[model samples]
Target: MQIVILNDAAAVAAYGANIFATQLQKKPTSVLGLATGSTPVALYQELIAKNKAGEISFSQATTFNLDEYLGLTGDHPQSYRHFMNEQLFSHIDINKDNTFVPPGDALNPITACKEYEDKIVAAGGVDVQLLGIGRNGHIGFNEPSSGLRSRTRVKTLTKATVDDNARFFAADEYQPQLSITMGIGTILEAKKVVLLATGENKADAVRAMIEGPLMAACPASALQLHQDAVIVIDKAAASKLADLEFYQHIEAENQKLQAHLATL
Candidate 1:
């Protein structure tokens, strides 16, 4: 449950990109868990910059996206598949064959969910997972009340998630009521996890995830139990944290250690 308070959203994104680059350096074919939403847009941009600089190459990497709207086709403007293409896939060198997004339009969504999890297992599991929290603390589309051990499955979206995601669609009516998402159990299997939050809208959720009880009410709180999870937030999003200075000191120490390792 490490927290990093960045000076701004760009700093958060830069740090996240560095983390991704570090993983790719260690394992050229690393399996990456990706997420959609405004919170990760800047991070994707930073990744693109790294790719352009030849600092990192995603050509051999495999990607598994967290979720997709159940009824939406891949071409739908509001679909997570489309969102990933526009935000990331198009700009990166990764092969299309190595990327997987849950089949949103599958006639049998339950089967599709099971197969999605199976695909991840066959790919050797995710090395690192990127997450964005919903306003209600949902991860992927696993809303509140989702069991900790739940597998990939179809989930009904809460009205708040619909509203928060409505901006991507032409109208609220276009938002899908159901989504297929990786379960918290699946996410916890990743070797490392990075969750990002920016803006004041996320402040309360960030505080609850870090300081509040690990109740199902806030699904992101489950990260508290993960051994290598990092929550990188901008100042605005970290506003509700009580021990802000303590977190900063810890990040500074981590930076010093990283620098020492690099010199060695």
Candidate 2:
């Protein structure tokens, strides 16, 4: 995992958006694995601005979201599908038919999960997967203790996850305790992964994901095994990482190397 600590959340969002912009410029048909949450809101906003400025276009791009609540439909106000539409899709030129989200209300979710995996494989796999690490180090709703090699499927949400998401619903409304998410192994198959986090609430998860052992207990730690995974965060989120100075030195050296290579 390449750890980058930015000055603030806006910096982190800009950095992550640049990754998507570069990828889209290089491969217009690139497949993107997306995540939903407050962490990615700013990044999506930046991408929308870039699209409007004619800096990047998603006309040929296809996107697959990481997860969806089990009890909702694509049209549901709080569904991941709607969230993506409101946050990023409606403003871009991408075909709505090209965007895929798990079938949260499918009568046969087992079959739905399998089909979701098939669609991903048929699309030539995700070029870059965008993610946000949960406070407990979960990725794509693959909560702590989730098998490292699991695939797309329905899984029960931990009480902690439900509580964390409670802020999004009314006090009387129910929050689904189940979700369909792409598995850790599935996410690792992507060509590149960009994980974003901000705020002090995420600092510990960031530390564990970047420096902790590669184990199921901290699902985000699985990124350690990926060849190209970038963890972008603001100082608040990166605060608990003990090797901050070393990471900064490495990034600086890498920048110098790239600059020299560009002149070659």
Best by TM-score: 2
Residue 148 in candidate 2 has what lDDT? Answer: 91
lDDT of 2 by residue, 1-264 (tens): 788889999999999999999999999999999999999999999999999999999999999999999989889888899999999999999999999999999999999999999999999999999999999999999999999988999989999899999999889987899999999999999999999999999999999999999999999999999999999999999888899999999988988998999999
TM-score of each: 0.97, 0.99
Cα misplacement distance, residue 94 of candidate 1 (Å): 1.0
Count: clashes, candidate 1: 0
Error of 2 at 28 (Å): 0.5
Clash pairs (backbone) in predicted model 1: none
